[model samples]
Target chain A: MVKLTEEMKTAFSKVKIFPVATASKEGVPNVVPIGFCQLVDDETIWIADNFMVKSLANLEENPNVAIYVWGPETGGCFQIKGKATIISSGEKFDKMKAIVNAAKPGLPAKTLIEVMISDVFQCAPGPEAGKKLL
Target chain B: MVKLTEEMKTAFSKVKIFPVATASKEGVPNVVPIGFCQLVDDETIWIADNFMVKSLANLEENPNVAIYVWGPETGGCFQIKGKATIISSGEKFDKMKAIVNAAKPGLPAKTLIEVMISDVFQCAPGPEAGKKLL
Candidate 1:
């Protein structure tokens, strides 16, 4: 397990949207743009699923997920990969629901996906690109 | 194979960055933010490899790739999934290298990734989210 560094945390906070990717057990891949992804803690991230059908299905079949975030202003990019768990009714889910409702009203926060970070990688294009940070 | 619609083409043109995802043969997934992704034709896309390590490795093991693009201004998001072919030296590679150099100088355009789009999906959050566009 790897913890997010301060720079990684700051980069993620600056991102308004994230592109999340997941694969089926058969290796078919899917990617979607998510607007409600937030870091719950250094080692944990929560994604409020508003209208995700394929992503949820893929997660059910395979727990592994990768989320890509980039800061437009700072030109910083990072990818966080981890195992995901779906939360429908729980304290974490409730908190995520409330937060999602406050930010974007009327959308049902159908599920909260909790990702436990296993690895972090630099995504910016350079020598360090794709290098594992943790 | 699915061809891109006018709206999808326009949405991709409006994007300055793209988050591309690929999985290895073993099903390990990776996502990275790419700044040099462009649509070559309605059914073809090109991505200049400035500094991609794991993404390239994953592609070698599995040709399937998913690229996510969203327009911040129009609020349109789309995912294009296809099989990728890497071009090291060819007409396509030369064109992509010239374009990459003209757009962002000083970086080596190591490879040109050509994607033959097989499927397109709407990524916007709504009733149609995750719906296959083609």
Candidate 2:
């Protein structure tokens, strides 16, 4: 089991948004910007949204997802995947919203998509990853 | 449906490899380095290998996949998804191999994974994507 440190949380928290990749049964995929993800513990990250996009619908059918978070520089790429457990209305959703609001003030409130993270991995520098391949 | 460009083909062809993301029915995920992917016309990308891993097995059960390609800069992230059409030992397989060999030489031969693309999208700069969310 991988653990998320404060550094990882800080790295993820500083960013206002991340791109989520989702797909449907027919194999059509959608990527969009999401404004909320919170560190639920050392092993969980949450996302909140209620858009009826392909990505959201895809999650209802298939919960598998990959989130890409890249920094201003080329080296920071955080790719995370796990089951997207839909907590539409519950205490968990409320807690997640509070976290988001506290982290990012003045943002509008919306539905939430929480990802119970199973694994998180960071990519090395581009040249390093390429060299390892070759 | 978006079409692939010769420039996109050239951009993908030069690379010797790209990382693949896979997950099991239980929701555990994995990411690995794979050295095979070929542009099949304008809407398909083929990957080959015979590793009995989560990504492959995930495809066997659930063929939904998302591929991320990022350049070594502030931009250049091509996120694509579609069905994984497995074409083993046939005319399509042979054609894909030839393309791979021509694009990259002296590489080891392996099984192929074909992605029948349905949608393709490009990400703008980090600030631009961030602003759209805020």
| lDDT tens per residue, model 2, A31-88 | 6555565667776677766333455677788787766455554335556666787776
Docking level of model 2 = incorrect
Interface RMSD for model 1 amounts to: 1.1
Residue pairs with clashing backbones, model 2 = A47-A113, A48-A112, A48-A113, A49-A111, A49-A112, B47-B113, B48-B111, B48-B112, B49-B111
How much is the lDDT of residue A112 in candidate 1?
94
Tens-digit lDDT track of model 2 for B112-133: 7878776555543333321211
> What C-alpha RMSD separates each model from the true structure?
1.6, 7.5
Q: Report the Cα lDDT for candidate 2.
A: 0.58
Give the per-residue lDDT of model 1 (tens digit) for A1-134: 78998878888888887888999876778888887888888999999999999889989989999987776654677788999999999898899989989988899999999999999888777898888888
Candidate topping lDDT: 1
